[model samples]
Target chain A: MNAVIYALFIVLPYVSLVVLIGGSTYRVLRWATTPKGGGGLYLGLYRLVNRAGQRSYLSAVGHILARMLAFHTIPKNSYGRDYGTWLSVFLFHWGVFLLIAFHLHLWMPWLRVGAEAMYVMGMATGTIALGAGLFLLARRVGLRRIYGLALNALDDYVAITWVVLIIALGLAMRALAPPGLFGEAVAWATGLSSLHPEPPPAFPLFYAHVLAVELFMIYLPFSKMAHPFTFPVNPVLYGKFEDVDEVRRRVEEELGW
Target chain B: MVSVRKVTYGRGGRDILEESPMYGEWRREFEGRGSVHVRIKEETDEGTLKAIGVTEMQRIDRGASPAERKRFFASRVAEMARENRAFRHHMDACVHCGLCIDKCPEYLGTRDPTNSPVGRADLVRRIYRRLNKASDGLLGRDVDDKDLARFLEEVDLDRIWTYYYQCTECRRCSVYCPMGIDQGEITRAVRQIFVEMGMIPEFNARTIRGVYETGNNMYIKKEAAQNVLDFVLDDMRQETGRDFKAAMDAERADALLLPSSTDFFSNIGTLKGEIAIMDELGLDWTLDSRALEVANFGLFEDEAHLKYIGDNYVNAALRRGVKMVVFGECGHGWRAFKNYVAPRLEAMGVQAISITQLTAWALRKGRLRVDKKVDAVVTYHDPCNLARAGDLIEEPRFVLRSVVKELRERVHNREKTLCCGAGGGLLTDELMPLRVWAGWPSVYDSLRTGAQYMVAPCSIDKAQFPAVIQYHKAPIKFKGVSDFVYAAMYGLDVDKIA
Candidate 1:
């Protein structure tokens, strides 16, 4: 049991991390080297920069950041006034964001919080994330009969359900378990991140949560979950004005026109 | 309260209410391909493909063996995916969020998910993905003969031809897409792939051939074109009491104008308005009989054809020794000129400007004055090409405000404007059902505005919206921005314009 936990937690994570980094890098390289002919990504960037009037790479980047971070595209206009889905999406995204940020404490031992505070913060964020995940999953499953049959892939539902379980387990651990259970896991994480492998507590529910996350990380690069890494490839979000010129040159040169 | 559920065909004729498949399954076999039975190698009647310049619907297969056909299409898809970043990103970025499902006009009208932008894009995207996998051999996976056969079978040429044509390529879906995935780009890529397979649509091919043969889609001879211009100019003189000169192929002019061939016959008022503005501003502009078209149907087909057709206009302007080329009231023509041809034109030391920009400039500079504005309230329809593609949203509105008593904006105006459904060469009589359904959103929105006239800046809108009004029994009249501008300049009363 210890060896399995050790391998899954300490050893397998490194392998998953390698696959994530390497696989994503390969996809990115493939995108970069691919001889794109019409203005796809570049056209979007060109429009953005051209609209913003700066017409520079920095302006494109700044606009992309504002759009992505500030949720600039999510208002009634972009999402077609579907405020229900929009609210759920907003909650799910920001919930995941806060949850990811909170998990950074596992790697930094110095950033320890008091038991009561950790419990409170964990319950609050975990509940929000769990609730949002449940809402999204329910919406997907409920709409499957009406509109989902044409759009809902199995992976879509699985991704949502997987995250929901992870968050739910986390909330359970926060509310029911003794206060210091994560302290050992945090120490183990800190040690493992620093190249010294440490076995965490032998709690079955805790290990179940950890294993689910490991499976997710391992599956990330191969599935749509890798959208974050490839987000910059979307022309509308990441294109610049200069890209139009680049696209024209590429088409002319590559096609030998 | 339009019945949005009227559109019914789902995957493989399965009632969407009964049983539907996931998006992945939907792509492999969704046959919501309207009623058009396009068979490979079976020649369609020339009269049925009733479009300008087309003589016959070419046989799709052209005697290629199935293996050769499969290889040809597969290789093109592979090549496009390997080369085009926009194609790659759009194909790969779709997470099947289905956010674009409810927003599509075709989907809303037809209730077929396949008509939705994401659904339409998925048709090509799946093929692109399969091709990518075969090429990359990701995870040491090799594509076997059976896999290839399955792919070829699923991506049927007939289905591909039907679905690709059904889209308007409006990019409305992109505006609402969470990842900013422009399905239109993917549709363009897919259509390009089809064109490579030698399966040219009769309307697109014939129109393109006409442009190459006679320098315009209408195939009007230079003598006939000049005659039409002279007749319109004579009428303008009698109506306005001003000698507005319409020059043909002047050796050296301040600017060259390109108006849609349709403007010469049907929508002549807009052309007269253009002449009035040019005359008032004292700008020496010449309209060449050889390049007297602002509509480029090649934009709806393939890039090569677009360049081929676009070159004619550029050559016409250069031959005239004009310093600037101003596009008439045509949307897609402006798109082709600005996005595709403008760079090359700019490099050649000639400027390409839209009529809206030129008129707005004249108005701002106080070069052209309108003593009396038209009293009727008018609504402006932002042609998707001008608003989304060319960024001429405010310029047309500014000109409209200058000429009209009141400008009422539609519920979905500028950037988010609905297409008049005649775009992307889906203007044929055979596709009237699709057109009327897809046109519902815009027609509905226009009706909601309660304006007397729905004034669009594109010539296609001028031709398409009147039918929409007649079909719905709506009281609104369809006209152009230039038509009102002409009225503001010449008509004794606003009622005369109305």
Candidate 2:
């Protein structure tokens, strides 16, 4: 029983890491080899203005990060504009993002904060993630009709359910004891990289959260969850609303204006 | 069973426009049409296909049953992914975020979920997921022969024909998508796959063949086109007493004007306006039979045809020894030229400019003068290609504003412009109802503005708006920007002359 528990907690993480890295690398390589217009598919972006090269890298990075962080595109869509899916999506995405950052503090000691500050931050982020995640799940299932949409595939249902489960389990751990599993979690999480893998605490909520997260990491490369990894980093412009004159001026300079 | 003209989209004769519960009505008719939309394979010219050097795939064996035909396509789907990288990336990237659903004009017009961008993408994405074994069967299963057979059942001729053609390939949804997954690209790739398997719509297939044989989609013979131009110049001389003239490839010309064949046959006013503007400015320009068609219909099908059609224009421009190739009124044709073909020209130390740009630039420089603003209140419609895709948002409006007394802006203008339902080769007699409904938003917006004239610098728009206005009983008249310029230049009241 102990060996089995050890396998789930320790052996499974490296296996998950290998699957995640291997799967993503395979997808990228598969994409790299394919021909787009008898040329490589990865040959940068579809340049609209002939001479308008890439904007400064810093600005593009900031612009891409802000657009992704704010979930600004949702509001532009009709359902986002009319039915308020934008706000719901914004809350859900950020809440989960902050919650993950908080979890990362255990793995990276440099990100650690004061115990009292960490307690307050942990609880706040957990409640937000759980609340928003549940709403997202409901929108996928029960509230779909209200949004004038139907769930697309079995993948849609499973994706939302998995996310909500992780958030709910994490929230439960935070609420039930608040400070019970920190040392054990830190020891186990930090030790995963070391030769001697440490054991996790015998707490159901903590075990469940770790289990859900590890399984999700393994599943990420195969599913649509792989989108965010490439999307934000990809060179293709997404909702960079420059004034028409500004775009025109930038292009004209290159066109011998 | 309601007549398409009388299908008012749920509004009283002069009431404010709102969406009527007409989507359900449309859904029945569209689905009922199904694979009947697939024209006979005779439309696909094998010789033209070879001339274009199209990447061939396994054609459907006619003796096999329909089920066997789909099975043949099942194997070829993977080959398509291998041949086109953009196809694979777009297929991989769609997250099925239902935000893009209503962004489609077809879905908004028809209210069919499957006709929506995400919905259309999801259909092919399901089979793609299983085919590539990208997703394991937590919900998505691994593909064995039995799984492949079961999965291929989901990808049918009717589903591919109806849903993919329903899109106008506007890129409206792509602009709004956070990840920029263009459903238009996916639709083209799917169309290419089916086209290889000896299936394509009559309208798209016939038009491509027309371009190859006659140097224009309309198949207007050179002699017939010359006679029409002469007759129009004669009419201009008689009416306004202007010495407007067009010649076939003048020696030492600085630029070549490739007029849309539609302008030669249908929108003669546009040709007259272009000739008048260039003549009044004393810009040296000539027309040639080799590059007569300004619009490239090849863009509608796939890249093979796009390059083939584009080569015809490039060769003509090179032969003329002109420094510039000026495109007259066309939508996606301008996009193909500006984005794809312009770079090639620029590399050769030649430039490609739209007539709108040329006129707008000349006007700004005070080199070309409009003698008078035509006595008309005009609303400008931005064709989809010229706006977001082509980066020509302001140039046409600048030209229109110079020629018309007042330029009224539509609610959705510039980057947010609505598509005239007939772009991306969805302009066919059989798809006329779909076109009318898809064009409702543009017509409704124009009507609300109470503009006397609706001006778009697109041949497709010039052709489409007439049908949209007549069906919706809209009072507004449709004309190209050039018509207004010509009217303004001659001090002719467009209402009387046009």
Candidate 3:
């Protein structure tokens, strides 16, 4: 393999993995240590599933999942144009999530996803993601052009524009890849994970897709893309986890109100 | 308060900042965010909380020269950006999605870009982002030195002070954040950092200090408080021909009333209703002088003070050995009690209930009789804190329906409520227009009900709605639910309220 190809595929993947893992770790730990002062008891992970609280921990989890993941928090005042914003947001996020989920077999070849099934699901998800990505880009730009609203010159443009590019590139690869191209890519993926140096597909689209994915991973920790990982810091609900009375009885008796 | 963003920042009010090229465009974008937006005060006033021995007040640049102040601000910003987790997470998490724009009353009222929740969060977020990028530069990442400097230049002591203070910490924007990032928590963290540097708004500082110094938020001494309570009791006696007695700081009682200081000074009608209900129920209840405040100003600043004020309740409950603690008609205060202090009280086997809850229970039990409907059409406004955080949406309405001739409902009620803008200690002379602008939606919504009287269980609403109603020249009268209850108990018109 050429040095450029080797750096992009082998060296780049390892480097991206290191930065992503390290940066995400730093973010999670940093958020966890931030001084939360509302007198929470710093309950253990058990508290998450602990059924003892006034509002069941599991119930709180369900509520928060419905809120964050399910996009249940429609802005109270998002009546007219916001419905469009909501639709674009909903389509783009869920499309990207499913696209990524379907791509999981590349990292786990033993799943044995048939090529026909892969082609069908990949085309569906990729088409959806690509369309939603273009729509989001247009909406972010169009709203600013027409309405002069939520126009972040830097963060918003960079974040959305990058997603659109990544999705567009992935769709191109998924639609037009030659036979055995994906097999080579899968061999490269498994080999890379197992520390063998099999070359990725020689196709330019395959190289472009992998490079973009790696760079995206590196950028993930730097940008607000880290939101999903850092969500524990901003948990959906402030529901109490412990049965306060029971804990209080067991706790060291402080004789103040 | 669906105010359009005006094109000019030449407003004559103190709400408009003096022309500065640095944030001039930002100012123009938010020109009409509220009726006016507040400029962060350049100097501290008489009411600024002093370093009163109990709290350690750090003066970063209080008595420093300009150069020293600059250095101090830089150091504090860097330290907080790295050490404060809440600020870091929020600054990193917000994607500047404009969903928060229409949601924030400050932004909607003023149309100021910085008044927007995302805008305000970004004002701090930009500086902190630069700070983070600078730190990231240590790892060999390319960062623009001039860009960081420019972003840092956009925020200074005054800019940070002005924009952040505009947020009432209402959490209205947080409700819609898909990420669940609570901007209220971010505001409190930033405010606490400023407060540590002896930079606090006089109104918030004074209120907090008053709670610390005296038992109540208004710092009315025991004699003055007692006189007001006595006068209220006497007024009730003459009107209703029923002798209602209330004790202050009773050694023991079945329940303790954590009344807002306004109950004694500004809204005695609420006091009268509370007294009559507790008496009618035939339960032993006492209003403790040491813990009469229902406004927890500590929530606007820091957790230490939140705990400090909350301890007054714990100590009051322990001292009285009360089986229940009945919180008064205060919005944020009840929220603080419910989310933070109530569970602690419940843990100790003492039931924590609101006055609205108690009155609703009493009325529901058919134990308290309403002789006649209040001679008016009434509308109810849900205080943001109580409805959103305190689980108190229907109780006040239940009590209102029990007494009013006709109850009209506003478009925005219950958890999806608008803020009084006067909340989060924003009820100051400086931000009067901002308050009015923030109060516009609710005031007008209440007016739309064609109700002669508009009532809310929140003390802040009772305090804010009157001024807002007067400003808009809306003929709607604003009162507390307790006031209507008092009038209904005696078959009196709303005008009978003194």
DockQ-based ranking, best first? 2, 1, 3
Interface root mean square deviation per prediction: 8.1, 6.9, 8.5
Residue B50 of candidate 2: its Cα lDDT? Answer: 46
Pick by TM-score: 1 or 2, better one: 1
What pairs collide in candidate 1? A35-B83, A36-B83, A36-B84, A41-A235, A45-A239, A45-A240, A46-A240, A46-A241, B7-B110
Candidate ranking under lDDT, highest first, comes to 2, 3, 1
Model 2 residue pairs with clashes: B137-B140
Label model 3 with its docking quality class. Answer: acceptable
Measured against the true chain A, the candidates' chain A TM-scores are 0.81, 0.77, 0.80
lDDT of 3 by residue, B1-498 (tens): 112332221233222122122234334544434332366453555344443322365656477765555446655555665555555566677766667766676764566555767767766665565666723333565446565555445456676677778888777776777666667766776777777766777666777778777877888888888888888888888887889979988889988988889888888888888888888877788988888888887787766677778878888999999987888889888767776677778779887778887787668768789978876788888887766666667778899999997898887676567788788878888777677776776766676678898888888888888887777677888888888888888876666656
Candidate 2 residue lDDT tens string, B47-147: 55443344253366445687787776665556666666666777777766666766677765555566777877877776676677755223344467887
Chain B TM-score in each of the candidates:
0.88, 0.88, 0.87
Cα TM-score per model: 0.88, 0.87, 0.85
Can you write out model 1's per-residue Cα lDDT over B295-412, one digit (the tens) per residue?
7776776666676677788888889887778889988777777766677677887777778877876676676788899888888888987777766778889998998999999878
